[model samples]
Target: MSTVYDCSRPQERKDGLAAAASAVRSGQLVVIPTDTVYGIGSDAFSLSAVHSLLAAKGRGPDMPVGVLVGSWSTIDGLVLSVPYQARQLIEAFWPGDLSIVLRHAPSLAWDLGHTKGTVMVRMPLHPVAIELLRETGPMAVSSANRSGQPPASTVDEAREQLGDSVRVYLDGGPSGDPVPSTIVDLTGDEPILLREGAVSIEAVSEALGGVQVGRPR
Candidate 1:
């Protein structure tokens, strides 16, 4: 059975977060609440763990997993480059709900399920989620639910879908926002808005001095 931790208590929150981080380091999955929604995360560098995460989510290889990082250095280590324009966007709405897809650093060995030499990275604004990410370095995170299922708005909702598949559940109450992160692909010369969610298309375009928004694939 998964150990569900109530983050309402200060001490329990710390202990639970520590255990969650440990789980990620040991190749175990954990359901964490982010600013946008609840996400199931595994160690980004663990190839096997990433595969397990995909299986748990019933996700296919063609669908890439987005990455959650604690800071810019972690982002730099994972991606080929963070363009100045992209950096502007990152600065403008990071730790919130904007995900930027960048060219993956070839030397960094990690599989996020057919990312096609690119990675979608985000810095979420949730305290518990960011704390866990900082402790775990980086994690391959996907919304907490089976593929095509509505995202879990609360920890219990996530627990219902993930259950024993997850080692720990950090309950941070309602996600507050059911909207997913705005995904902007900056791997090419032009920034492409792959999906619009919490961050609007106009905001992204303005941050990059104007860019194209594409229909979701």
Candidate 2:
């Protein structure tokens, strides 16, 4: 990757944001800051770009990547189903550390690792991430590291693994408390706790008013 963009620097941040967004629009990958951890982001609508992201991370096509959005409206548009309980979770934990896996809209022509019909969507709270999402519409983002390696919490770490695979790096410093977002599957009969991370299962259950959810194995 080229020079790491110091996102804390105002002018550099503005320029970096523009460059990053442009790169994404052109189906290029960029290391970006998210509320939970650093992510390798690309245009979600671009199948080739998504493949590039998977290839860069040394990830298999079977394991799908998650899509990051700027607002609830965008989430609603990209997904076909959004149950009442899912809405509740979004309201409670969105723009924070929560990921919702919902059935993807069949009308949309995008492949996220041949995910069948589901896509994980998140709305991050970080300023840099939000701005980029706002400009890019939706980005397919995964942890900025090789598939088996521990997730990178800083731009330097991401660059170390990703190297020239990514075109640009938005350095937001070490991601504070690099826990991943909680993942919940809403396509099943009931909400299933896929992975508990920043948000606890207790919080999710409470948000749903004691709805039963499958525990992580």
The TM-score values for the models, in the order shown, are 0.96, 0.97
The lowest-lDDT stretch of 10 consecutive residues in candidate 2 is: 208-217
Candidate 2 residue-wise lDDT at 4? 76
Give me the overall lDDT of model 2. Answer: 0.91
lDDT of 1 by residue, 167-217 (tens): 999999998859999988877656778888998999887777776666555
Clashing pairs in 2: none
The per-residue C-alpha lDDT of model 1 at residue 189 equals: 58
Candidate 2 local lDDT, 1-217, one digit each (tens): 4657999999999999999998999999999999888999999999899999999999888999999999877887888878899889989998889999999999988888968899999999899999999998999999999999989999999999999989889999889888999999998888999999999999999999988778655
List the pairs of residues colliding in candidate 1. none
Alpha carbon lDDT at 180, candidate 1: 90
Best by TM-score: 2
